[model samples]
Target: MRELVFALEYEPGCNRVADALADHPDARVRSLSLHATAEQLWRVDHATGTPDALDAIEDAFLTSDYYADCLATEDCGATQTTRVLDRTDDTLVLYSDWERTPSCASVPHIARDHLGESVLFETRHEGRHYTWRLIHSGEGDVAAFFDALEVAVGDCARMEMLRTADTTASVGGSDETQSGLSPEQEAALRAAVEHGYYESPREVDVGELAEHLDVPRSTLTYRLRRAEEHLAKQHVADERLPEDPSATR
Candidate 1:
């Protein structure tokens, strides 16, 4: 589930639309509506959980000038699948209903008007099921504004996911190198192993070995990790690498 802000062009006291809908038998508590702006309508729901008939409801609102344009079709009604169906002239619908199944827990929130004008919103991603309204004081296409907003929200989500993955890999040895080190680093690693630098006598602390090799401690650790990874890989490739193939010969 995600939260979304809606920027509408309604008159004062028009915020009751959501409350009225809430009284309906079909409305879900998770589907909340609030006024973020006097002219706007804010709504929230599970993007992936909504019914397929939402587009029809949206079309209903759009054709009716945001519900402020007065009801035309006698069949203008709502179902559990239709959370909002407006018929007012000043009432515009701004919604966030994009959903993905087999999806991550995150939802994208958006707030824009019919002319695509932007309204105030919190961070790049929608945290949870939320609905709020914003008054679009500017002149812009609501659809275009929302399109851009969606793109921005999506980009932010991607960046956050990538960053989280990178951090996790760094902390958990996720990016084990094939060679376990660059050529130079591997040379140092071989030297450390042969010199018994990593053995139990405490003959060489990491810092000491790093200094002896004229390399930084950080560099030594990195090389060691690489070396370990490489050796492990080689052990898998040639099982004899661990017991000294030269000794057997």
Candidate 2:
């Protein structure tokens, strides 16, 4: 199988949902499940943020012009609905079913059209960026699909190709273990690495990195320390275990 990861950033005034996400940098949305067909698309999303942010997101989602456009009769024929499956002070579980039409040129539909119905999708939304990960059997017409996606977004959004590679190769070696790190820890570690916090000269300090991530310096430091300790333990464990038991004397 192959994995394709990409991101989209819609211009302001182009998509209400995107606008709400952009407005709340501290908020995050993740797709728990997604299934799309020619007739409709079903998605369940988990959102986390301040209560005010969650409220704004819910409001924007319920009355989004993007969803409205998909349900427009001029575009296609189908029923459209959304429900709040669950909610908390700072979290929300949302379910949406959108009827598809020719005018509905969403990523899922475009992917299904090009990569077939067997593809798996995962998505994350943060700040102004919406990222998508697609896993599919064999190498499908990825270039064509990207082209169609660009056309679909037209002048509204910018598309970025993040990664495209064989799933097995991308998973590192066969003995690679999962990093037992929380999402925040992983984010902190990633930002640190990307910003050269570990360079010889230390291109960025903890305070600067924390500021860049919009997080408290102490919080970022704690997360990075925890992540580093976890990874160090994993490395030691791997070193102690021989790939072949018989090879150990």
Which candidate leads the pack in TM-score?
A: 2
- Residue by residue across 1-249, what tens digits does model 1's lDDT show? 112233221222222232223223132223333223323234443211124233433443334322321111232332112334432332323443322222111122233323333344332111111222233444545456555544433422111110101222332222223443345555677778777787888677788888888866645654575458657776677765477678989
Each model's lDDT: 0.37, 0.76
- Which regions of candidate 2 are displaced past 4 Å? 68-79, 170-249
Tens digits of per-residue lDDT, candidate 2, 1-249, equal 887777676667776667777778778889999988887889999999999899988998897655722412233444568899999999999999987666666788888888888999999876656778899975578878988888877877677654566787833222223454555667889899999999999999999999999966645665676579778987898899758867775
lDDT of 2 at 40: 81
lDDT of 1 at 228: 80
Clashing residue pairs found in predicted model 2: none
**TM-score result, candidate 1:** 0.25
TM-score versus the correct structure, for each prediction: 0.25, 0.69
lDDT of 1: 0.37
Cα-based lDDT at residue 43, candidate 1: 48
Candidate 2 lDDT (Cα, 0 to 1): 0.76
